[model samples]
Target chain A: MDALLIDPVLARACGSALAVILLLGAWQKLRDMAVFEAAVELYRLLPDRMVPLFARALPMLEAAAGAALLLESTRGIGLVLALVVLGISTGGVLINLLRGHTDIDCGCGGADGNTRLSWALPVRNAVLMLLAVAGAQAGLARPLVWVDFITVAGGTLALLGIYAAGNQLLANHPRLMQLRNGS
Target chain B: MNEALMISNALLWVAVLAALIGLFALARQIGVLYERVAPMGALMIDTGPKVGEPAPSFELPTLTGNARVRIGGAADKSTLLFFLSPTCPVCKKLLPILRSVNETERSWLRVVLASDGEQPEHLAFYEKADLKPFPYLLSQDLGIGFHVGKLPYAVLMDEQGRITAKGLVNSREQLESLFTAKELGVASVQDFIDHQHDHQRA
Candidate 1:
């Protein structure tokens, strides 16, 4: 079952998709460090002493991991770091959800950082982590071909478009609920 | 027979690729809908007075001394009631912006600053912030009436005292969104965008 799921071609496509998403997220944090810091503060999961340092370092770490994921030699280390980072963020979202702090920004970037926490966020992270693990475990089955590259490109674009759509829907959920409740 | 099989395989790949493109297009359409429906302007909590309803009336003492001010229910000017605090850094930052907004539309708009805190601290804020141009009212009752749970909140009321728009405003853009919503006769910017999208589709 595991071997069936960890197909090398699928793994490469997942790696590319995950790298693009993480790189975009990291770039947004780097673009506006202050906004990212404010979002971290809202989570209230980090100590005051650690918040500034973590805020400064997290984007750099994500960007490095994303870049490394695209390279053949560093792909292993990149997968490990991607899993760790995705786990930490999933933990953050899960903690905030449990605490009933639903209004804070997810800091995921894009759509003006307006994306709020929802059940979808942690689920999305979990899905990415699974993809990262599959990519890390994938073994070469055969030589590459032009058709294989085309498949990877199409698959990655499809995955990313769906991901973007999901994030936007999560952001819209609260407003739609409000509109429904007539408040 | 072999050539026919190869042609069939190529056709299958083309069909799959077309299906992927169709799925992607559908996802992008949903994204556009989300973008139009979500409130990117201001973070509005659900506890507040509902937009389009009459604002809860309050007669509170103004900081300018001796004269009590009445809010809500049929006024000469539309009210831009802002809830702020002396301690909130964001609220303090917004004072100048609010002052300019007050100055620019002095005729049709009545910008009233409301807060619930110690009198002396507010007095100091009033003096140091140079908020003499606006009516700064110190009233917990007004804040409670509006169900303002956060600092730097704003509510726009029409001349008939109907709540046009209200939300937790952080930036000047968000503050301006309130006015924009009012001008467009929508409850919020999200609604305005959705309305426009529906019109376009129609």
Candidate 2:
């Protein structure tokens, strides 16, 4: 299972997908700083004063990590940062879940901000982290030529679209349940 | 031979990429269908009184002095038991909508507001919201009895005081759904959908 997970194509696809998601998340946080701040506040993880500071700093860090992931030289550092960031945030969600604070907004950036903290979120983060780890196992077996770039681009785009659709489905599940049950 | 192998590899990659994109597009279509099917409304938690059963009976004092209101019995009028909290923002937002519903359905429906909290705080909230139209009662026991884990919940009882529908209502649509469910003689939206499916099959 472990060897199958770290295939070169899968690694490249996961890396690009993670990078795209992080960049988009960073851009969204930059667009609406206050909303992101409020979302961070909802977590109740950081002290009240530090909430503002963390909210302001998180987007920049994500952007840096995203940029590094795209560059061959900085890929390792980027993967590490991605791991740390994803790990901490997943931990935050886990803490809230254990504490029974599932009603709080996840503050995951962009259209997903309204999503409440739940088990699915931490699991999503865990999957993303796994992708990042696979991506970290760099040094491809074959030397990449011009043709490889096309393959990577196509693979990345495909993965990103699928990831977005999956997230949407996750967000829609609760509403579906409510509708089914007859609110 | 080497050149041919390289060309085939490139073609294979392109084909795989195209296939993946097609899969993604199909997933998007499924998402659109999911959105059309699923809607936002109150959630019916599988706890407390089940539908078609007698609502737990209770006598609680009205917010006003020296008056007691009866809940869950063979009352001639159907009852809309709205559970709210003074501190709940959603509950506050739903108050006006509840009032309008009460006004429109006054002849056949009796809307009651139930909460579990300090009397003075509730009185303050009632005054602030100008809640003179509905009977407001304070009872923690009632909330516990109903197994209300969330705020802004509503329960509909038929004229015979049996629970027709109840769920954790968050929006006006959700609140209305309870009535719609009861009117259709279904326990929930899912039940209604299933019944329709069965009818179609028949």
Candidate 3:
């Protein structure tokens, strides 16, 4: 296994470098207005039954994933974060292709300029996955602890609360309306 | 007084315990739904507001259509909404299918054919379908809020104005798969269409 075989110092170096690239990538994505718009478009395409709760939580996670990748202390944390980002991006596009709705762009990581599904996306991910595998091997994280589960459970619940409140706020306040209207 | 009251109190506690169990189950279901929706943002379509979202309240003044009707109001009934355009050809195919459903489903549901034209040609299409007396509302009031880009769009709402359904109501099976029932039937547009097809064949 790469974890057992790879040098920890080398792995850490690789992870730190990958983290910089990912953080820069995430920053670009965060800066692009259209990336956010694409996300909203995606939100619109979802079935009514599933929209409300997701519309809030996913964006926040993405924002965090980008931010955490740059920090040196969160080196191993960054790999896990990168896995989540790549896994969802690669998998979601493939699933959407299967679902028969292909008009929209994949919009992966500030990818507004890229129109077509190219070799770049999967290639980027494959490399990231390798880097993450190396770091994960070095870090040798244990299986999810009870504390981790509790944390995710608490986080998920907190996400739900935030969504509920945001929906209510968007409903009652016209400031959300202003955002909708390009203000 | 002491013994009889003690027995009554025990029964009360049992009832309370059962309610808590039911509520916990409901919370778990909500959690599961939350997990499903997260991270799949690009796939969701704009429904009148959104599905599971509280529908926006609006009533439009029409020159050709009948009186203004309130959408997303707690009218104490179920409503099937269509955010449609006169020029949309898909909507032309969808209307008859909906009318047939409206006829078969009866008074349990009301279809509101919402359109956003200040023109007469658009109103003429409504005259053609007749909508089985479905209330057609104009959308001059809230075009940006509704995100009226496409046609043949539809939504289902509860008595409380939260969307039960949205997007192109494609098939009876798809709707049935999406629908969940509790307490009373808010009715389903999917079942209504499928049964109507079944009835016509029968």
- Cα miss at B75, model 2 (Å)? 36
Off by over 4 Å in 3: A1-183, B1-48, B62-65, B170-202
Q: What lDDT does each candidate get?
A: 0.77, 0.76, 0.52
Residue-level lDDT tens digits of model 2 in A6-30: 5566678778888988888889887
Best by TM-score: 1
lDDT of 1 by residue, B101-136 (tens): 887777678999988767886898788668887888
Arrange candidates, best lDDT first: 1, 2, 3
Candidate 2 has an lDDT of 0.76
Q: Which candidate is the best by DockQ?
A: 2
lDDT for A174 (candidate 3): 26
What is the docking quality class of candidate 3? incorrect
**A153-179: candidate 1 lDDT, tens digit per residue:** 767776777677666666556656755
C-alpha positional error of residue B181 in candidate 1 after TM-score superposition, expressed in Å: 16
Residue B127, candidate 2: how far off, in angstroms? 17
Q: Which candidate is the best by lDDT?
A: 1
> Chain B TM-score for each model?
0.69, 0.69, 0.58
Per-candidate TM-scores read 0.60, 0.53, 0.35
Ordered by TM-score, highest first, the candidates read 1, 2, 3
Please give the clash total of every predicted structure, in order: 0, 2, 13
